[model samples]
Target: MSGDAVLDLAREGIWVMIIIGAPVMVVGLLVGVVIALFQALTQIQEMTLVFVPKILAIFVTLLLSLPFMGAILSGYMARIADMIVTGG
Candidate 1:
């Protein structure tokens, strides 16, 4: 493949990664912020308090987004495989 083709593949790979990860990252960020605010208001300051909820929330989000994520990943993989097969 040409350098431009390689670069395009790399760029597309990164875009796919971002698209797949964005939901989880966004959920984690929102959960963390809410937990922070709650902690501030209640002054609990428990370490596990911060971790458990975020983990659970992200896990739930991951579960919910699994199909969407799978489709995206599969599509990317198919594109890559097609490129490989066609000798691009």
Candidate 2:
């Protein structure tokens, strides 16, 4: 493939990664922010307090979003594979 085709594939790969990861990351960020706020308001400065809830929240979100994530990834992979086969 040409340089432009390679670059296009790379860009699509990055976008797929972002799309696949965004929901879980966004959920974790929201949870972490809320937890941080709570800790600040309560003056509870436990170092470990930040991790467990975020982990659980992210896990739960992943579970909930698994099908959607799988579909997106599958579609991207299929498109990429097709592009490769067609020498795009």
Candidate 3:
């Protein structure tokens, strides 16, 4: 592949990675912030208090977004395959 095509593919892969990961990461961040706020307001500064909810939220987000992620990955793979076949 040409340098330009390689760079374009790399850029696209990065975008796909971001798109696939954004939902889970966002949910996790929101959950962590909320938990931190709760801890602050209630004065419950337990170190392990943050993990469960954040994990659960991230898990649910991933489950909900699984199909979308799969579609994105499949589309990327198809493009990669096409490029390989075409020797681009």
- The model with the greatest TM-score is 3
Give stretches of model 1 more than 4 Å off: none
Q: Residue-wise lDDT of candidate 1 within 1-88, one digit each (tens)?
A: 8999999989999999999999999999999999999999999888788899999999999999999999999999999999999999
Model 3 RMSD, rounded to 1 decimal: 0.6
Each candidate's clash count: 0, 0, 0
- Write model 2 residue lDDT over 1-88, tens digit each, in one string: 7899889878988988898899999999999999999999999999899999999999999999999999988998898789889877
Q: State TM-scores per candidate.
A: 0.95, 0.89, 0.97
In candidate 3, position 13 carries an lDDT of: 95
Candidate achieving the largest lDDT:
1
Model 3 spans with C-alpha error above 4 angstroms = none
Model 3 TM-score is: 0.97
Clashing pairs in 3: none
lDDT of 3 by residue, 1-88 (tens): 9999999999999999999989988898899999999999999989999998888888888888999999999999999999999999
lDDT of each: 0.95, 0.92, 0.94
Candidate 1 versus the native: TM-score?
0.95
